[model samples]
Target: MKIAESHPRRRVAVLSTVIAAIMLYLFIQDVFGAVKKQEETEIITERSAWLADWRWEAGTNDLEVVAGGLTSLQVFAAYFDESDSLLLTDKFREAMPRIKQLAEQNELNDLYLTVVNDIKYPNDTDSQKNTSLVTRLVADWESRSRHIDEIIAALETFGFTGAELDYEKIAEEDWPKFAQFIHELDYRLQKKGKSLRVVLEPRAPIERIKLPKGPAYVMMAYNLYGGHSGPGPKADAAFIRKHATRMKKVPGNSYIALSSGGFDWHSGTGKAVGITEKQASELATRSESTPERDKASGSLHFEYNDSDNVKHTVWYADGTTLSQWIDAAKAKGIQNIAIWRLDELGSESLEQLRIQPGYKIE
Candidate 1:
């Protein structure tokens, strides 16, 4: 009877061991499967960046580099004529075919015609960010309607997907009318099955003012340092975070626009000129001075002298800097990024733009 009992105990022990092993295998599989699913979700949420502002002055070389990589592109095409009607530049006319071809190749559904508040003179020089024009257009009902009609006609003529209002330097008094104009324009565009995007300056009183719903709003996060200011990075982590927090007040889908270049500030003169990532990098290489990254801004700055022995202080963003800026914005829970004017961007910066988001540039 004792031997029989011992055999039964042995059988029970073996069965218990087999069940535990099976349970362990299932637990491991469940954890790994969940991790895999989470990774896939992250990939889907973290998408590519939206690019814009292919200026005629900048040419189409940068566009050629980006090509199908862009989900949508804003061509800096439309400006105000002498009559305040839409004036398409000659360069715009010449580049439309290439632009359309690129759109076709990329199958882009969001090709926007960026119309700035710039008045182009007969001689082709533009008076940029004219506040008077914003007041005049929005304050007068007829002018605003006519302008919208012209924009619609232009969009239809050029096969553009939508219209982007890059109007800047709006006065505080003009905010109400501007918001009304946006609402009316949005209505018309929706009725016609078109889209609209509005660009807001960093100085715009987002919290104090009321903005219309529907159209996407892009906040200009650069220019923390520019021609208007002394030598500094175009933006820092704190600056981006502050703007991202403020952008929450904006309605609908909002994007934070990041600039890819820096400015060259000449000392004593207090004048600065815009320089692209490639230009800045080449300038540093030529000067034989390595650029030092600012920890707060993740931007590179270096000083060099010209043939005239004039001291020049340069601050700019490269690939790694852009990545850091993107990370800062991401930390604030803002994902949509729009690059300001992709012109002569460095190869490294271009690579950073092309890669999937959430990955750091090392």
Candidate 2:
């Protein structure tokens, strides 16, 4: 009887030992898994901290991802009708919710409403059509003042934090009127606790257009090459440096707008078409071409043959090129960097900016 009882007790002890071993294994696995997850979280936090010193501005358009992971966003062109009244398109209204969502996710300050007078949409139509209308509007002080008042009312109604005046193609003669209009609008917007931003051409007569205090002036430093122009770097390093120097002379806050997209120029007709980075890469791959970077311009270019057997040359900026531009801008004392359209930025391009040294995302 004693031998049989001892055997049963020994079997119970073996079973208890197996259970303890399994429990220990699970505990170790859980601890390692948690450590790995924490490391990943830390890496993500560090990545997001990049670009903290500079303001990143993107324009909102048909692309859903335009505002993704950006610091600030501007709604594409709320146009002005022939009556000098502000027109908010249905498309812009529809895009606001998504833009706001992205802003919240990225911890952005506020969404900016861009005001323009360009008539055509879906494509950047010629501003020539609206030039006459703008001239008429600015010529009449009373009419312009009333129009500005209406714009202020619309801003309050739409819940926009600020407004970006993107009125393009003004005749050089109308520079003073345009400047006065901005001054008045800036004054009124400030009273309501709002801000104003002006988008000026790289060659814009900065001396002529005097902005009111507290308004940011964004220099359009892109379009050095595009669909309309011959295939070349969108903006060369030398050109950017020259304009950056001019931007420094401006009195208040200023920003440099850079191009991150490329244009596919048809070798036959010289007709260039806008293409995203992904599209450009896919085309290059299909044509068995490798993109080459121009060290002098800091741009990437490639030649590809299409289904029609037509040879085309593509010129655009990528992550590496943009990184070089940012370095140059920082060295030149540029405080803010704005990409023309955010949707053009690829994952790789964004990653390049993330790993750049000496910047933090706040």
> In candidate 2, which residue pairs clash?
49-361, 52-360, 52-361
Determine the C-alpha RMSD for candidate 2 after optimal superposition of all C-alphas: 14.7
Which segments of model 1 are wrong by more than 4 Å?
1-59, 356-362
For 1-362, candidate 1 gives per-residue lDDT tens digits of 99988998999999999999999999999999988777645532222233333354353566666655566688877888877778887778877887677667766567888889989898858799999988888987898898899999999999888899999999889998899899999999999899899989888988988898999888889899999999999999999989988899999887888988899999979999999887888889756568899999999999998878889999999888888998888788677788876787888778765654353322
Poorest 10 consecutive residues of model 1 by lDDT? 43-52
Tens digit of per-residue lDDT, candidate 2, span 1-362: 99988998999999999999999999999999988776644321111111110112223332234334444556654776545567676666665665666667656656677777665444544343376767876786897788788778777887777888777777788888887888888888889999888888876887656655678888877788886589998888777787888887677877777877789999899999987776777777855657889987788898888889998999888888877876676557674776665554676676653342233432
The global C-alpha lDDT for each of the candidates, from Candidate 1 onward, is 0.82, 0.69
List TM-score per model, in order: 0.84, 0.76
What value does the lDDT take at residue 173 in candidate 1?
A: 94
